[model samples]
Target: MKQPLRLHTPRLILRDFQREDSEAVLAYQSKPAYLEHYERPAPTREEARAFVDMLCRWAEEQPRAKYQLAITLDGGQVMGTCGVRKAAPGDTVAEYGCELDPACWKHGYALEASRHLLTWSFETLGVRKLFALTRPQNLSAIRLAEALGFHRVEDGRYELTCP
Candidate 1:
């Protein structure tokens, strides 16, 4: 499988994870506000390194398939991650998720990253549909999903598919 490599948007670059990203990942994940509703908060540096290593492994194994990308601004500031992963056998779809720095919120970064991944999933990976699960209290994410053309499917689930 060819690795899922870097993609560029107008103001951002979505690329594969790098070991160097550990510190930035920690900076956002460590924030109490960021983890308030997340089940897993930021990990220690060692754990973060492991997590990033996992991302690199996934990218290499699946290529244009299941992948986790590091979202960075043009200037190389690591913002967060976005990705698509294959769903269960009976599902015939893919799951998507993202996390971004709070300091970068409300600037359309999430939408840009998501759009890029969704396009890759459909056009590159041939995924038929995409789904996302977010906490009910995370209204911002819910709204962003809606704005990106995902329809609410349940309390904390949303979905989108290629036409």
Candidate 2:
């Protein structure tokens, strides 16, 4: 709901994206592993800048429908982004997901950040259900979803209902 929005876990902070985060985002986004399942080509510097600007703009909305945050270590080096977004203000359901730098993969950062995002979405945002749409071949994402207590609702769709 504000510029400095943040959610915390034991090992990380999920904070609002800042302009300075553009370069880090670009660097990770350029990796072959990161792009493996994505259809779009790697982003240019200007595209990355615009993307961060858009996240900042979304944060400024009156009844924010999205929380696209930067995932950072406690020491403040950003590793990736995570988000839970409703289709409209006051919706009881949202879509959520996270991505980390390829180098950070398998280290549990995505799991840690996603667990915190799920909690924040359910508690702070009043969301009753959170769903993730992962690519069919993204086995790591599938495993992470299952590990977090999300059940497969349908092909490519996994869901976690609030307790």
Candidate 3:
């Protein structure tokens, strides 16, 4: 099956990553607020390019193991990213991750984009289970996951089992 490059919601579009998005992504992730909960330091532009390139490669591979979609406003401004990566062998699960521009916080974009991905995971990818991990102190992310119907499965881990 061909993986869709763009998913539409009322207010956002989750589309494929592009070189042009590097600057916008860097603008958000480079901030201290955005990187505070991340274990690694904020990435430089070069690092972001390398990261995007890797994601693009994965998206192109057959039996794609990752879906790295750029979260954009309806007007097409790069606002964040939302995607899923294959879980490790024996896990039979996939992990979801997202990062949004601080300027776009509190607008429900994360939850909307997450719901879209969860639907794709279950209906399109035929994934049986999905999960996410976030810093416990990151209340916003935690709330967003819960709102997307992912329950707390363990410390820093939330899960949604397909019905």
Q: Name the candidate that leads on lDDT.
A: 2
- Per-residue lDDT of candidate 2, residues 85-119 (tens digit): 88998999999888889999988999889888888
In candidate 1, which residue ranges exceed 4 Å CA deviation?
A: 1-4, 62-64, 87-92
TM-score of each predicted structure versus truth: 0.90, 0.95, 0.90
As a whole number from 0 to 100, the lDDT of residue 69 in candidate 3 is 88
- Predicted model with the maximum TM-score: 2
* Candidate 1: tens digits of C-alpha lDDT, residues 1-163: 5645889899999998888888889888888878876888568999888888888877776223467899999949688999888843334488888889988888999999988888877887778888899999998889888987899988899999885
TM-score of 3: 0.90
Ten-residue region with minimum lDDT total, candidate 3:
84-93
Better of 1 and 2 by TM-score: 2
* Consecutive 10-residue window with the lowest summed lDDT within model 1: 58-67
What's the ranking of the predictions by lDDT, best on top?
2, 1, 3
lDDT accuracy of residue 5 in candidate 1: 86
